[model samples]
Target chain A: MTNQKLYHAHIEACVEAMNACNLSYVANLKEYNLEKLCECIRITRECAEICSFTAQSLSQGSQFAGEIAELCAKVCEACIAECAKHNNQHSRECIEACRHCVEMCKDLMVAA
Target chain B: MTNQKLYHAHIEACVEAMNACNLSYVANLKEYNLEKLCECIRITRECAEICSFTAQSLSQGSQFAGEIAELCAKVCEACIAECAKHNNQHSRECIEACRHCVEMCKDLMVAA
Candidate 1:
C-alpha cells in the first residue's frame, strides 16, 4: 500500500480503539468501579490523541515519523495491557483495538 | 492534587495538544509540505491517544498504572521533540502541552 493509505488505515484503527475505550468507560460508569473506569477513560483519551498525531505525522513523513511510530507502539501496548484486566465487553474491545494499532504502528516504524 | 484531578488535567492538556497539531496541519495544507504535515498528524494523534489512556489509568491506579505512566512519559517526550522542529505556533503549543503532560505523568508514576 502507499504510505498515505497505510498511514490513514493506521490512524483510523487508532481512533476506533480510542472511541471504543472512551465509550466503554462512559457507559459503564454506573458500575462504580472508579479505578477501572478512570483508567479506561485516561488510556482511551491518550490513545486517541497519540493516534491522531501519528496519523498526521505519517501523512508527511516528518523527520520524527520513525521515532513517533516507535513510541506509539509502546504506548498502545501499555494501554492494551491495562484494558485487558477488566472483564467487560468494552475493555475487551478496547484491548483488541489497541493491539491492532500496536501492530500497525510497529509495521510503520519498521518501514520508516 | 487528587489523583483524579491530576489525571483530568493531564488528559485535557493532551487533548489540547492534539487539537492544536490537527488544526495546524489543516490550516497549513496549502503549504503542501506533505512530509511534515503527515508526521505532525501522526505524532499528534499518537500523543493524544496515549495521553488519554494514561489519564484514565492514573485516575484509577490500575495494576498497569506505573507501567503506563512510564510509557506515557516516553511518548510525550517523543511528540514534544517532533513538534519542536517546526517553527509554527501550533507545533510550539503542542510541544508545550506534551511537555506539561510528560511532567504530570512522571509525577503520577512516582506517586504510583
Candidate 2:
C-alpha cells in the first residue's frame, strides 16, 4: 500500500482505539466516580489525545511525526499497563485499542 | 505557580482551545461537507485529541511531558493556520484557542 493508504489504515485503527478508551473512561468516571483511579484515567485520557493528533500528524507527513510516534508508544505503554488493572469490559477494549496503537506507533516511528 | 498549579492552568487553557476547535469542526463537518477541508478537519481532530491527552499527562507528571508538549505545539501551529482561513465564528474561536495552546506547548517543552 502507498504511504498514504498505510497511514490511513494505521491511524484509523489507533483513532478507533483512542475513541473507545475515551468513551469508556468517561462512562466509568460517571458510574463509579473512583477518585482513586484518577491517575489511571489521566494516563488513558492523555494517551487517547496523543493518538488522535498523531494520526493527523502521520497523514500530513509532519516532520515531527516520527518523534511524536515514539513518544506516543511510551504513553500507550503506560496506558495499557494502567488499563490492565481494571477488569471491566471497557478497560479490556481500551487495552486492545492501546495495543493496536502501540504497534502502529512503533511502525510509524520506523518509517519516519 | 507550583508545577501542579501551572500544569492545571496551561493544560486547561490548551484543552479549552482544543475542545472548542473540536466542537466547531464537528458542527462545520455537518453543515458543509467540504472534501478539500478534509486536511484541515483532520488536523483539528488530532490537535483536539492531543490537547486532551496532554492535559492529563501534564497533571500526572509524565516523564515525556516535555516531548509531547513540543509535539502539541507543532500540531497547534498547523491547526491555527488552517483555522485562520475561515471567517466563521467557530473557526475564529478555534484559531484563538490554538494560539493559546501553542504558547503553553512552548512553555511546557522548555520546562520539561
Q: Name the best candidate (by lDDT).
A: 2
Location of the lowest summed lDDT over 10 successive residues in candidate 2 chain A:
A27-36
Per residue, candidate 2 scores C-alpha lDDT tens digits across B42-73 of: 57777887887788888877888888888888
After superposing candidate 2, which stretches have Cα over 4 Å from the reference? Answer: B1-112
Indicate the docking level reached by candidate 2.
incorrect
**Residue range A9-70, candidate 2, lDDT tens digits:** 77886788789778765655554435445556557667877887788777776778778889
Compute the lDDT of residue A43 as modeled in candidate 2.
Answer: 73
Give the interface RMSD of each candidate. Answer: 6.9, 15.2
When superposed on Cα atoms, how far off is each prediction in RMSD? 10.8, 15.2
List clash counts for every candidate, in order.
Answer: 52, 3
> What shift in Å separates residue B84 of candidate 1 from its native position after superposition?
32
Instruction: Give the fraction of reference interface contacts each candidate recovers.
Output: 0.00, 0.00
